[model samples]
Target: MKIAFPATGTDLSCLLDGRFGRAPRFLVVDSETNSYQTIENDGNADASQGAGIQSAQAVIAAGATAVVSVHFGPKAFQVFEKAGIKTLQADIAPISDLMDKFRQGVLPRMQGPDKAGHAG
Candidate 1:
């Protein structure tokens, strides 16, 4: 399974970015191999509108099966749900620790967006 984490840097040691859509980048990790690729989110990072939708589309295109982030807007949550991608809530932590929590099923799965639309 490929799990995506919103990150402030490219490596596993990077801090998890709190803003889902506006994250600087996304670290997509291969669970089996422990390898990862960083997808730049600069486009959405500065977007004044539709950042959530755009970011969600990017994640889908990157083939993420699940996402671990601090929050998701309503629109992004809907997009992920429709795409059959799981969304999990995670507090700010290292990418490695977040992945461990996800692997252990300790992270909470988000049923819906915790915040309103267009929240940066």
Candidate 2:
């Protein structure tokens, strides 16, 4: 399974960014190989109108089946739902620890967005 994490930095040791849409980048990890790649949020972190949508789109394009984040906004959650992507919630922690919790099935699966959409 490929999982994407909204990250504050480029590696597993880095802390979770806590905001899915505004994260600087995403760290996509391949479960089978334990290898990973970094996907820039493509300036979506600074987007005024559609950050969540664009970030979700980027994760989908990265072929991630799941996204682990502190929280998500409504529009982004809807996008992931429509794409058949699973959303997992994790507390603020290093990406590596979050992955460990995920492998242990301790991370909670989110049923809906934890946050409201950005207000224009």
Q: Count the backbone clashes (under 3 Å) in each candidate.
A: 0, 0
lDDT of 2 by residue, 78-103 (tens): 99999999999988999999888888
Residue pairs in collision within model 1: none
Report lDDT (CA) for all predictions: 0.91, 0.91
> lDDT score, residue 72, model 1?
94
lDDT of 1 by residue, 20-109 (tens): 888988999999999998899999989988898999999889989999989999999999999999999989999999888888999998
User: Which residue ranges in model 1 land beyond 4 Å of their true spot?
Assistant: none
The window of 10 residues in a row where model 1 has the poorest summed lDDT is 111-120
What is the alpha-carbon lDDT for the whole of candidate 2? 0.91
